[model samples]
Target: MKLATLRRWFSPQTTMQGKIFFAFGLITFLSIVSVTGIVYVNMRDTIKHNAVTSVSDSIRQADESLNIMLEEIDRLNTVVVTSKNTVIDTIMSPNEEISYEWFQEQKRITEFLSVLINYKPYISRVAVVGLNGKVFFTGGPWMDRTVLGTPMLNYMLQNGSRHAYFKPEGAADAITVGREIRYNRETVGIVMVDLDYEFIKKTYGVKPTADSLLYVLDEQNGYVYQSESAPSSFAPSLEKVVEIKRKLAGQGDVMEQKINGRSYIVVSRLSEYTGWSTLALIPLDSLLSESTRIRNLMAEVAIIVFIIILIGSHQVSSRTTLNIRRLRSMMMQVKDGNLSFPKTEIKTKDEIGQLYRVFVSMVDELKRLMEGIRNSEKKKREAELTALQAQIRPHFLYNSLNTIKYLAKLNGVPNIEEVSGSLIELMRGLLGNSNEFLTLQEELDYVFSYVSIVKYKYMEPIQVHTQIEDESLLGCKVLKLMLQPLVENAIMHGIGPSENGGQVLIRVYAEDQDVLIEVIDNGKGMEQEQMDALLGSLDREDAASRFSSMGIRNAHERIVRMFGEPYGLSLHSEPGLYTKVEIRFPKIHHAETSAQEVV
Candidate 1:
C-alpha cells in the first residue's frame, strides 16, 4: 500500500501541483548548483593569479633597477676609453714620449673619472689598465692585478670594445664590468668599472615580507646571490634550476612546483643585462588562505539560497494548482451533464484564465446545440402529423365524388356522371401512394383526368397540345402529380382568366442529363413584378401562402425536394402574351420489363 501511494505521488499522471513543484524545485536547485560551481572555480583561480602577479611585478622592478645600474657602469667605462683627453693614449704611445703634454692629459682624465664616481654612488671604483704596463685609478679599496686578469677580462678584450660582467674570486658581493680600449684602430688598454652588487639585495630586501626569499641564478655560473636571512640550501635543486632555465627560454614566465612536499608558486624572469634568471618562490598555503575563507562563506550563502528557493517554488506552485483544480472541478460537473451549474470565473489574465473562458464558451455552445436538436425533433413529428392530415382530404373527396357519380348515373345525367368520373380518377391519383414517383405515361393519364374535370367546370373551351420528342421517354419516371397541377394552374390562372380563351401546350423531352416537361399557355400573362414575386416565392420555405393554388407551390417544392434544386420548376411569362412553366427531373427510366408488362 505504501509503494502504491508513492508511485501515485511521483507518477507523471499525478496532479499538476506535484508536477509544478517538482519541476520548479529541480530547476532552481540545478541552477544554483551550476552557478555556485562556476563562481567557486573562477574565484580560486583569480585569487592565485593576483598573488602570482604581485610577486612577479616585485621581481620585475628589481630586475629593471639592476639592469639600469649595469648599463650606467658600461656607459661610464665608454666615457673613459673614448675620452677627449686621451690620457691612456698619451701614456702608452710608442709614437710619443712622457712629457708635460702627457701629464696634463692624465690630470684632466683623472678629474673626469672622479666626477663620474661621485655622481654614481653604486660604482665602488673605476680604473683603466694599459697593455704597455701603465695604469690609472679612481676611488680606494683597490684589488690585486690577478682580480683584473680574470678570464672574463681576457674574453672582453678578445670580443673587442664590448663589456662583460665578472665576479672576482675573493670579492664577497661585487660584480665587475670590463671593456676593451682602442686608440687609432689598435688595442691600447682595458677600462674596468666595479659596481657594488650588494645593492641588488638591498633593493629587494625592503619589498618582500621577511618570510619571502629571493635569489639570482647564472646560466654559465652557479648562484651569484641570495638574501642574507635565506639559507644557502633553501634554493631549488640543480635539476629544478635546469628545468627553470629551459622553461624561461620560451614564453613561460611562471611555474608551480612541489619542493620537499610543499606547494610553491615559482616566478622566473630572464634578465637582459646578464644571461641569468631571477626566480621567486612563494608558499601556496599562505597565498590561498583568504580564498579558503571566501569559499566557505559562499557555500553557506548557497545553502541558504537553496532553502529559500524551495519555499518560494512551493508557494507559487500551490497557487497555480489551486486555480487549475477549481477549473477541473467545474469541467467535471459539465462532463456529468450538469450544464445548469454556475459558470467558471477567473479574474487573472493568465493562460489558465483563457482556458476557463474557452470552457465556458464550449459549454454554452453545447447547450444551444442540444436545444436546437430537441426543437428539430419536435418539428419532425409535427410535419409527419400534418402529412397524415393532408392525406385524409383527398380520400374524402374520392368518396364524395363516387357518391355523386352514382347519383348522376341513376338520374340519367350524362354530363354530371362524366365529370364525377374524371374527378374521382384525379382524386385517386392524388391519394395513391406510389413512393411520390410515376412514369411519364401514368402522369400524362392523370393530367388528362384533371383537364376533363376542369373543362366541365368552365364554360370556355381550352385546348392542350402535347408533343413528346422521344417516344421511349414515355417510360421515364418522374414525381407524381407533377404535371396535373401545372395543367390545372394554366386553366384557372392563365386560360380561364383570358377574354379570348387560350390553349395549353405540354411538351416532354430529354436534354443533357435531365428530362424536361413544359406547360405553356397563351393568355393574359402576369406583369413583370407579379411574375418575379411568383417565381421568387417558389424557392421559399413559406411559399404555400404566396399563391391562390397551393398546388403550384407544393408541386414546385416536391420536384426540388425529390430531385434537388437543379431539377425544379421555372416560370417565364410576358403580360398579355404567354406564360410558360417548365419542370425538370433526373432522366430516370422505368425498367423495360415493367413498361412491357404494363403494355
Candidate 2:
C-alpha cells in the first residue's frame, strides 16, 4: 500500500510545486530574453537610422559645397561669354573714325583675364579664339602652344551658333569650358576658359577618415573629373559613370549604395543654367561612429537591468515557495475522500492568499454537495450507466454495419453494393476517433460529407454550397468538427421549418493573418426571443447549461481555449431573412509529421 502511494505520488502529476517553479523560472528567463532581444533590436535599428540620417546630412553638405563651386564656375562662364561679344563688337564696328585704340583694347582684355584668374584661382589659363581661327589674349604662352589644334577651336568655327561646350582637355584629363562669341546674333569668335585639374581635386577637401572619400564626375559626358588626393584608379569607375548618367537622366538627386567594402551616399544636382551635374560621395560608417558608441552604452545598461531582475526573481520565488508549502500542508488534511477544509489564516491579499481562500470555499461547498449526492447515488449511477451504454451503442452499431458492408462488397452484391458503400463511408465518419484538431482540408472534407448526407435527407427543402478562396490554406489547422455544428444549426433552426426551400452557403478564406470561416443561411431565421434564450444559455457560468447549448457555445469555448478569447465565433441574424455565423482564428500550420513540428 505504501509502495502504491509512493508510485502515485511520483507519477507525472507529482511535483506540482517543482513544475510551477520550473514554469516561473522559464517565464522569467523568457521575459528577460525577450526584453534583451527587443533592446538589442531597437538599439541596432536606432544606430542604422542615425547612420542613414548622418549620411544624408553629409551628402547635403557636400552638395552645398559643390553647388557653391559650380555657381562660381557659371559666373565665370557668363562673364567670358558676354565679354567676348563686347570685344568682338569693338573689333567689328564700322565706326573707324571713333578713335580706334587697339593697344588699349588689348590691355583691357588682358586685364579682364588677369582679374578673373586672380579672383578664381582655379582657372589655369584663359584665351579667345578669333573668327579667323587665330588665338589672342592667352593666359600663358604654354597654353597657347598646348591647345593649338584642339577640336574646341575647330568646332566653334564650324558650328558658330552653339553657345557653350565643355569637354576633356585631353585623353582622361582636365575639363575645358568653351563659349562661342556672338554680336547681334552673328558669330565672331570663341572664348576658351581652361580650369586647372588641381583646383577640381582640391574641391573634395581633405579625407574625413580612412573609410570616407569624396569625388566629382562630369555628368553630361559620363567621365570622372576629380577625386580626393588618392590614387587615380580610386576615381569613379566607368560603370559608376553609367549609373550616374542613367540616374541623372531621370533627375535622381540622391543615391545610397555600398562599393568596395565602403557604404556611400551619393548626391547629384544639375546646374540650373549650364546643365552640368555636381555629385558628392560620403561614407556611411564615418557618419554613424558616434551612434554606435551610444548603442554599446545602452547595451551595458540593459545587462545591468537584467542582473537586477534575476536577483529579485530568485528572492521572490524562494519566499513564494515557503508560503505555498504551508498552504499545501493544510490542503493535504482535506484530501481523505471527505471534503473538510482547515481554516487558512493567510493575511496577505496577493494572488496566492486569494487562491487559498478559494480552495477553502471549494472544499466547504464540495462537502455540502457530497452530503446531498449520497442519498441519490444509486439511482443516479444507474441512470448514468444507461446513458453511457446508449452513447456506446451507436458506435458499435456503426462499426458492425461497416463490417457487413465490406462483406457484401466482397460478394459482389451489386444493388446492395452501392448502398452499402455509401453507408459504410457515412458510418466511418460518424464513428471515427481521431485528433481534436485537424487541418482545414480535413475539416472541409468532413463538411462536404455532412452536406452530402443533409442533401440526401432534405433534397426538396434545402440547397447547400461552399466556396474556398485559397486552396493552399488546406495545411492550416482548425478545430475538428468546427464547421459541421454551425451547418447543422442552420439547417435545423434556420431552415427546416421554412415554407420555401432555402440555401446554406459556407465560405472559407484567409484575410491578413487570420483564417475566416463563415456559414450563411437565407431561411426562416430565429426571432429575438429565441435568440436571447440561446445566447443567455451560452453565457451562463454553469458548465452543464453551457454544454447543453453545444453547437455555437462549444465551438466558442474550444476556440478560446486553443487560440485565445479574441479569436472565436460571432452570431448575427436578421429575423425572417438570414442568419450568419462567423468564426475567425489565427492561421496555424500543423506539421505533417512530428519531425516537422513548428514550436
Candidate 3:
C-alpha cells in the first residue's frame, strides 16, 4: 500500500501545474543535452581542421622570407662578377699601356669596391686574383703564404664553371663565389667573393612563435643554416628532403611532414640564382589553441539557450493573450461606429505593437472616408440651389430689358429700333443654352458684341480698344462667359463716375501652355481691401451674399472647377488709377471644323 501511494504521488497527472512543470523540465533537459552533444562534436572537428590550416599558413610565410633572402644574395654576386669583367677589359685594351701608373689604377679599383660593398654589406670580402696567382685588393685577413696559392684560381683556370662553395666546417660560416674574368676574348683574372654568414641569419629573423621553424638548405638537400631555437641536429632524411624539393621545384609551395614523432607542415621555395631550396616547418598543437577557446564558448552558449527557452515560452503566451483581448475590444468599438476610438499604448514594440500601429492607420482612413461622403452630399444640395438661382436671373433681366424698351419708345427716340435690336441680342447671349466650355474666339466675340452695345448706349464719351496676338490661339477653349463679367465689372465700377469717360483695353495672348487675357480700365479703381473682398469670396462659404460682385465670383468658380486652382481669375487695382483683371486658362485645341461651325 505504501508503494502504491508513492507511485501515485510521483505521477504526472497528480496536478495540472505539476504536469506542466514536468513536461517543461523534461523538454528543457533534452534540448540542452542534444544541443550540447551536437556542438561539442562540431567544435572538435572544426578545431582539428583549423589547426592544420594555421600550420600551413605559418609554413608559407617562413618560406617566402627565406626565398627573398636568397634572391638578394644572388643579385650581389652578379654585380661583383660584372664589375670584375669590366676592369679586365680596361686592362687588356690595345691602346692601354701595362705601365699605366699603378697608384691611379689602384685608386679606381678601390673606389669601385667601396661602392659595391656599401650597397651590399653582406659581401665580407671581394678580391681579384691575376692569372699569375697573385691576390690584388684583398679585403679579408691573410692566413699565410697559402692564401696566395688558394685553389680558387686553379678552379677558374681549368673549369669555366662558377662555384657557390661553402666552408667545410666553422662557427663563423661563409659562402664563396668564384668566376673567371674574361676581356677581349682572353682570360685576364679571377673574381672571388666571400659572403658573411650573419647576412643570412639577420635576413631570416626569428619566427613569431614556437610553432614555426625556418632554415636554408643546399642543392644536395643538406641543411646549411637554421634558426637558433631549432634542434642542433634537426635534419630530416635526405630522401625526404629530396622529395620535398622535387615537389616544390616547379610545383606546389607547401607540403606536410612528420618529424621525430611530431606532426609538422612544411613549405619549400627555390632560389632563382643558385637553385638552392628554402624549407620551413610548423607544429600543429600551438595553432589549435584558439579552436579550444571557441569550443568552450559554444558550450556556454548552449547553456544560455536552454535557459532562455524555459523562461520565454510562458512570457510569450501571457503577453499574446492580453494583447489579443485588447485588440478585440478596440475592433468592437470601431464596428459600433465610434470612429474616435481610444489609441492603444503598449510600450513593448513587439509584433503586437506593429499590429496596433496598422489598426490606427486603418481607423484614420475610415474617418477620412466618412468625411468625404458628407462633403459629397453637401455639394449635391448646393448644386441644386445654384441651378434654382440661375433660372431666376434670366426672368429678372428680361423684365428689366422690357421696361427699358418701353421707356425708349415713350421718349420718341429715333434710335428705338437699334436699341431694341441690341437688347434682343444681349438677351439671346444671356439666355443661350450652350455647353459650359466655349472656344476663346466665341467668348471674345460675345464680349465684343456687348462692348458695341455699351458704346452705342453710353455715346461717344466712352472709348474701348481690343488687341489680340496670334489669332490662331482663338481656337483654344475657355470657360463660357469668362470675359463678359470682367468687362461688366470694369464698366459699372471702373468707368461709371468718370467725367471724361474711361477707355477699356482687352488683350489676349498665349504664354507657354496657358491662355492669358488682361482687361484694364483707366478709371476709378478699387482699394486693396475691395480687391481682396472680390478674390477671397472663392474660399468663403457665404461669399456670394457678402459681396455684390456675384458675376465675377461665379466666373472664378467655373474656371477653377474646370482647370483647377492654378488657372483662375486674379484682380489687381489701385484706387483712382487703373483696375486690371487677368484670367489664365489651360490651352485647349479645337478642331478646325468645330471652330468654323460655332457662330
Candidate 4:
C-alpha cells in the first residue's frame, strides 16, 4: 500500500502541490542525511586518533620510570666493581689461607653489602659467594648458596668484565645482577644483588583502569610482566603476544587491531637501559562511548527537524498555490462555454499578482486573434492555388521532351532519341515524390541515364568502368539522386575541360558491417590545396558554401540526413594523380532493407 501511494505521488498525473512538497522535502532530507554521515565518520576517526595518542603518552611515561630503575641497578654494579677497598680484594684473592685475616675480610665484606641494602631498599639481597661455597651476605641471606651459577663467574673472568645480568632458571619474578671482585688480574669471588618483580612493577607507576591493560615485554627473552591494575579480561592471547613482539622489533610504536570481538589500540615504548618494552591496550569502544551518545541524540534531532519541515512545507505550498487553483477554475468555466467571469484580484507584489495581470491582458487579445486567423487562412488557400498554377511549366517541358524523343526516333537518329529519353527520365526522377528512397540498382539506372545525356552533350571520349562485388547489395536501399551529382561533377570538372579525357570508375562492395562506394576520376586530378577546398565546401552547412557547391553539397546532406553523419562522403586526391570519393553506409540485406531504411 505504501509503494502504491509513493508511485501515485510521483506520477505525472499528481497535483502540482504534491510535486512541490516532494521536491523540497526530499532535498532537505538528503542534505541532513549527508551531513549526518560525514559527522559520524569523522567522529569515529577523531576518537580513535585521540585514544591512541593518550595511550602512547602513558606508555612513554611508564617506560621512563622503568629505565630509571634499570639505571639504578647498573649503578649498584658499578659501585661494587670499582671500589678501592682492599678487604674485598683480599677475600676474592686466589690463595688458600686459614688465618684470622680471612675472617676479618668476611666481616668487612658483610658490612659493605649492608651499606648497599640501606642505599636501595628494593634490592632483596646483597651477597658475595666464593668458589669455596661460603657466602658473605646481608639482607637476610635470602637466596640459597647453591643457586649461584659458576658459568657467570667464568664468563666475567674470560671477558674481563666486572658485572653481568642473569635470570634465575626457575624463578619467575626476580632477576640477579652480579659483579665479579678481581685481585691481581684473577677473579676470586662474585657479588650478587637480586631485584624482586614487585619492585620492578612498582617502577612503572600505572594506575587502575577499567577497560585498559598494562604489561611489560622482556626484550632479551620475550617474557611478559603485567601490572596490578591490568584487567584479567583484557589479557592478550599467545598470538597477540607474538604480534606485539614483532611490533617491538620494528619502529612502529602505535597499533590498532580487533581482538576477541573488541577493537583495541596498543601503544608501546621501549626502554633502552632495561631492554624491555612497555605496552598499554585501550578499548576503542569504551573510549568512544560519549561519541555514540552524541550520534544517537543527533539522529533524534534530525527526525524531529524533518517532521517540522514536512509540515511547514505543505502549509506554505498550499497557501502559495491557492491563486493558481482559482485561475484553473476560471479556465474550466471558459472551457464550458461561459463567455465572462469575475476578475481575479491578487494584491501582493509577487509572482501570483504578475500572473493575474498577464491573464487579464491575454484574455482581451483572444477574440481579436481568432478573427485575424480566419482571414489569414482564406488568403493561404488562394496562395496555394497560385503555386499550383505556376507548377504547370514543368509539365509542359516534360511533354515537349517526349515529343522531341518521338521525332528523333521517326527521323532515324538514335543518339538524339537516346539523349531526349534520358532527359525525360531525369525530369521524372526529380519530380517524383518527396519520400522516395531508391534501391542501389534503381539509383544506378538513373545515374546511367544521366551519364548518357552528359556523354551525348559533351561528345568526350571518356571511359566509364562500373564494378559490383556483391550482387545481393544491388537491392540495398540508398537516398535517391545521391550518386547523380558525383557523376556530373566528374564529367564537368575533370573530363570535359581536359586535353586528353580520362576514365571514371565506380565500385561498390560490402566490407565488414558496412557498404562502401567509391568514384574515381583520372582526368585533371586536383592538387592538395584544391582538393582541401572542395572537401571543406562539402562539409560546411552554411548557405554560402551550399550555394557555391550546390550539387555535391545537396548529395552529401541527403546521405547524412538518411544514414547519419558517420555514413557520409570523404575525398582524397594528389597532384597529377587520381581523385577518389568514398561513401559509406550500413550494409543492409535486400530482405530486411525496408525495415532498416530508417538507419
Candidate 5:
C-alpha cells in the first residue's frame, strides 16, 4: 500500500508543479538534516576528545610535579642517613661506644637535620632512627622513635625506600616517606620524611573545580589527598573505584565512568617513583557543553534556511504551474469540441512556455483541419459516386467466364474451354480471399491453377511436383500467392530457352523451431558476382540478377518483414545445374497463425 502511494505521488499523472515543489522541498530537507546530523556527531567527538586530552595532560603534569617533590624528600632523607659528611654519617653509623667524639658528632648531626626542615617546605617532619637505639628528629621530637615503628618506615628499614599514607595520632593525614640506612653489610638506621596536607597542596597544587575533581590514590592503602572542592554528589562508590583502578591497570590513561549515576571522564597518571596515582574526573555534561550548544545552533540555522527556501520554492513552482494550467484548460476545451483559440500570453522560452506556444499553434492547425475536412467531404461523395460507376462486379465477371467456358465446351472447342477455365481459376485465386495467409495445401492448389495457365506457353508438359516431409505441414499457414511468383519465374526463366521443359519441385518440412520451404528448379543459374550483387543490394536488386532474383528477393524481404530478419530466404545455384530458393519462418500451427495475420 505504501509502495502504491509512493508511485502515485511520483508518477507523471501527478501535477507537474506539485512534483517540482515536492522534489525541491525533499532535497532541501534531506540535505539540511544530513549536514546537521554530521556536524553534531563530528563536533561531539572532537569536543569529547579535546576534553579527554586536556584532563590527561593536566593529570600527567600533576604527577610529574608530585614526583619532583617526592624525589626531593628522597634526596633529603638519603643525605641525612648516608651522607659522607663525617658529622651526619658518624652519628648514624653503627658503633660500639658513646665517647666524647660521638657526642660531638651527634650534636653536629642534630643541627644539620634541623637545617633541612627550614629549607624544604614540602616536608612536614624529618627523623632518623638508628639500630643502636639512637633517635634523631627535626620539627618535633614526637616523631623521633615513632617514625621507625610505622609500617612505611619499617618497610624501608627492612627492604628499601617506601612511601605510605598515614594519619598520625592527633595529626592530619600525611605521606610518610622513608629510606633505609646501611653501613657495611648490615643495616644501621633509617631516615623518614612526613609530608602534611599543606605540603601536598603546595606540591600537587591541582585544585578541583565545580565540574572537575582531583585526587591522589594509594593502591595499597587509600586516597592520599582529595580536593576540598570535589562535589559530594559525584563521589564514586567502592565498586566504581575498583572499576576505575582496573581500567587504569589495563594501560589506558583516560576512561568514561558513571559515578553517582552521572557519567564522568576519568584521567589518571601514575608516579613511578612514589607509586601514587594522580587522577581527575570531569563530568561528561560539562565536557560536551560546547558541542551541544553548537549542535543546537546548527539545527536552528538549518530550520531557518529550510523555511526560507521552502517559501522561495513555492513561489517558483507556482509560477511554473501557471502556464501549464493555461495549456491544460485549452486542451480540455479542445477535447469538448470547442475550436476557439485563446491568446497564450506566455512569452518565456522555458519548457512550460514552449508548451503554451505549441498548444496555441495546435488549436490554429486544428481550425484549418476542420475547414479542410468540411471541404473534402463534398469531394469525397463525388469520388465515391465515380468509383461506383467504375467498379466491376466480380461475381458477374466470374459467371460470365463460366458461361463462356460451358459454351466453348459445348461447341467442342477444347483449347478455348481450357483457357476459359484457367482464366476463371486465376480470377478466383486473386479475388477470393482477403486474408494474407492461407493453408499450405490451399496455396499449393492456387499454384497448380497458375501452372495450368502457363502450361500452354510450353511445347512440352511442364513438370511441377511437391515434396512434403510431414503431411501435417500441409495445414500450416503460408502467405497467400507466396509461391506462385517463384514458380512462374522458374518456368519462364529456367525452361524458357530449353526445347524440353525442366522440373520445378516444392519441398516443405520442419527443422528445429522453424518451418522451411524450398523451390528447387533445374535452370540456368547466375554467376557468383550476380548472386552477391543481388543479395547485397539494400534497396534494389542488380540488373545482372534481375529476372532471376526478383521473385526470390520479394519472398525473402516479405518473410523478413513478417517474421523478422533471421527467418528469411537463402539462395544457392550452379550454372546449367539446379537453382534452389529456401524460405524459412517460425513453425506456427494454422489456428495460431490465423489469430493475427496481415490482411
Candidate 6:
C-alpha cells in the first residue's frame, strides 16, 4: 500500500497533480536550458564575427584613402613632366653643358613645380633627375640627387611603365615615387617625388596599442612604416615575409601566426597604388577580450536563471498539487458514507477548484435522498422502496459520475474560434489591382473589416473608433495599403499582447493643405530609443529589429518620397501608456480612383 501511494504521488498517469507538475516542470527546465545554451554560443561567435568584420572594413578604407593620394601624385607627375616648355625643355636637353643659361632654365622650372606641390600636403620633395648631370627640385632642405647614380633608380627606370613605383627601402629614410620620363619615344630621365612616410601612417586609420601593431613593407621586404612600439621579433625576415605572403594567397586576407611562441591574428592588405603591403597584428587573446567578458557574464546569468527557475517552478507545482490533495481528501470522506457537503467557496478558477464545486453538489444530492428514505415506513413500503431503488440508486450513481467526467474533460479543450465572413471579404479585398490610390472612406472600410477579424482573437474585443473632422474629407485620395500597416502594428505590437484589450483611435483631419491621419492605441508603449530606430533608416540595429519595423518604414519612406520633406510618418510613444503613429500628405483627390471606393 505504501508503494502504491508513492507511485500515485510521482507518476504522471496516476494523478492530475502529478501530470500537471511533471509536464510544466520538464518543459520549463528544458526551455530555460536550451535558450541558455543557444545564447551562450551565439554571443561568443557574434563577437568574433564582428571583430573580424571591423578589421576587414578598416583595411578597405585604408586602401581607398591611399589610392586617392597615389593617384593625385601620379597626375602631378604627368602634368609637370609633360609641360610645354619648362621641365621637358630642361630635362630633355642633357646635350647642353651645365652653364649660366642652363641654371636659369632650372631655376624657372623649380619655381613652377614649387607652386604646384603646395596643393598636395603629402608631397615632401619633387625633383627632375637627369641621367647624365643635374637634379632640379623644390621642397624643404633635402638631398638633390642622392639616388641619381644608384642601381636601384636604374632598375625602376628601365621598367618602362608610366605608373610610379614607391621605393621605401631607398638610400634615404624617405619613401620615393619614381616614374620614367619618355620624350620623343626615348627615355630621358626620371621624375621622382619623396613622399611623407609619416603622413601615410597617420592616414591609415588603425592606431597601434600595446597588444596590437600595424606596419607596412615594400615588395623587397623592406620597411615602409614600422611601429616603434612593436616587439623586436615582430618584424619578420625576408624569407618569413615571403612565406607569409604565400600562405595568405592560399588562406585569406587574415590568418593566424605564431611569433616568439605567442599567437596573433595577422591581417595584411597589399595596396595596388604603392605596391606596398600593410600588415596589422593583434594578439589572439586581445582580439577576444570583449568576447571573453561576454562569455563570463552569460555564464553568471545562466546560473542565476537556473536557480530562479528551479525554485519558482517547484513552488508553482507544489502549490497546485496541494489544492488537488485537499479535493482528493474530500472525495475519500464521501466514500466513507459521510455525505455532508462543505461550505467552502470555490474561488480558484482552475481545474481542481471546479472539481471541488462538483464534488460538493454530488454530496448534497445524495444526502437529500437519504433523508427522504428515512421519513418513510419500511415494511408497508417495500414495493415503493424497491421501485425507488430501481429508479434512483444505479442510475443516479452513473449520472453523477458522467457529470464529474464531463467537467474533467471540458478543461482540456480550447475555446472554439468563430471565423466570420469578414475573413473571406478581407481576402477578396487583398486580391489583384488594389494597389492604386484609395479614397479615405474606402480605406476606413478596409480598416473596419480588418479589425472585425482581429476582434475574434480577444475575449473582450478591442474597441476601434474613427473620428473624421469633416464629412467631405472622406473623398480625399491617399496611397493604397498605407494606413492598414499602421493599424496592424497598433494591434499586434501595441495592443495584442496587452492583458485587457485596448482602444484604437483612427483620427483624420485637415491641417493646412495636407491630410493628417493618426493611428493611436491605448496599450503598452515603447521607449524613445526603440521608437527612433523603428522610424529611422540606420543599419546599426540587428536583423530582428529591422524586420519588425520593415512594413512601417516602407510606408513612411513612400509617403515622404511622394510628398517631399515635412511629411511622412512619425511615432510618439509614452512607455506603458500609449503609442501614436501619424501620417501627413497632400489632400488630393483623383477622379479615376473613385471607382476603387466599391472595393
What overall lDDT goes with each candidate model?
Answer: 0.75, 0.65, 0.66, 0.71, 0.74, 0.71
Residues 214-288 of candidate 1 have per-residue lDDT tens digits of: 667765545656556754565566567667567656758887777666677777787877876777777677677
Query: Any runs in candidate 5 off by more than 4 Å, and if so which?
Result: 1-37, 84-103, 161-173, 202-209, 219-221, 289-599
| Residue 197 in candidate 4, Cα distance off native in Å | 86
142-219 per-residue lDDT for model 5 (tens digits): 754554466655566655634333434334456777766666666777777777667676555553335677777665
Against the true structure, what is every candidate's RMSD? 25.1, 23.7, 15.6, 18.2, 22.0, 28.8
TM-score attained by model 3: 0.42
Per-candidate TM-scores read 0.41, 0.36, 0.42, 0.39, 0.40, 0.44
Candidate maximizing lDDT:
1
TM-score ranking, best first: 6, 3, 1, 5, 4, 2
- Give per-residue CA lDDT, model 6, range 1-599, as digits (tens): 98986588586466655566566667766887788678777875565566566766787788788778778878887887678588777876654546888878877988987977787888888887767666778885464567676765775586526765555354334566677777787777777776777676776657433657676677666766656666676655556656776677688888889866777677888887667887776676666667767767877887788677766765666777777777777778787866764644656777767887787877887787777677655644887878777666645554554555455456642211112334434544565334567788877877787887777777778899999999889998887778887788788778888898799999999988888998999888888778766766534454125224445677777777766788787789899999888898877778364422322
Ranking by lDDT: 1, 5, 6, 4, 3, 2
Return the lDDT, model 2, position 280.
56
Candidate 6 residue runs with Cα over 4 Å from true position: 1-36, 42-45, 93-100, 168-173, 205-209, 233-235, 299-599
Lowest lDDT 10-residue stretch of candidate 5: 161-170
Please estimate how well model 2 matches the true structure, expressed as its whole-model Cα lDDT.
0.65
Query: Of 1 and 2, which scores higher on TM-score?
Result: 1
**What is the C-alpha lDDT profile of model 2 across 46-148, one tens digit per residue?**
6555544554565455556645655675567568767644467444644333245655565666777777767776666677765643445645435543455
The lowest-lDDT stretch of 10 consecutive residues in candidate 3 is 590-599
Choose 2 or 3, whichever is better by lDDT.
3
Candidate 2 stretches with Cα past 4 Å from truth are: 1-39, 42-52, 76-86, 89-105, 138-141, 145-149, 154-174, 206-209, 212-215, 224-236, 244-274, 277-295, 301-599
Global Cα lDDT for candidate 5? 0.74
Per-residue lDDT tens digits for candidate 4, residues 1-599, read: 98986687689888777787898799889988998889887988877787777666666776676556556866876777667574356554554446677777767777887888787767877767665556667775364456456554554444436445565443556666777766677666677777776776666555323667676766444454665555567677656866865765685887776777778777777766666667777777677778979899989999999999999878766766897887777777767866467766766566876777777677667756777899889989999998898688779988999999999999999999999998888777777545456788877888888888888656556677889998988887777777777877777766667777678888999878788889888866666656566667666555223123545577767667766867778878765667787888776545335534533
Candidate 3 per-residue C-alpha lDDT over 1-599 given as tens digits, one digit per residue, 9 for 90 to 100: 98874465358555433344445657887978887778777875565455445545554554565455445545654665567434663444343224566445656766776666566666677666655433455466442235554454455456544544443333456666666676656766666666677866776554544646776676555666666776645545556666766766666866566776776666665666455666777665555556668777877887888677657744654576578678889989999989897867665688877888788888988889889989989998999999999889888877777777788778877466445656666666658645766677777767766775676656445666778898887877767778887887677667856777788898998888778999999878877766676687565554433233456677777777766768788888888899888888777775333322322
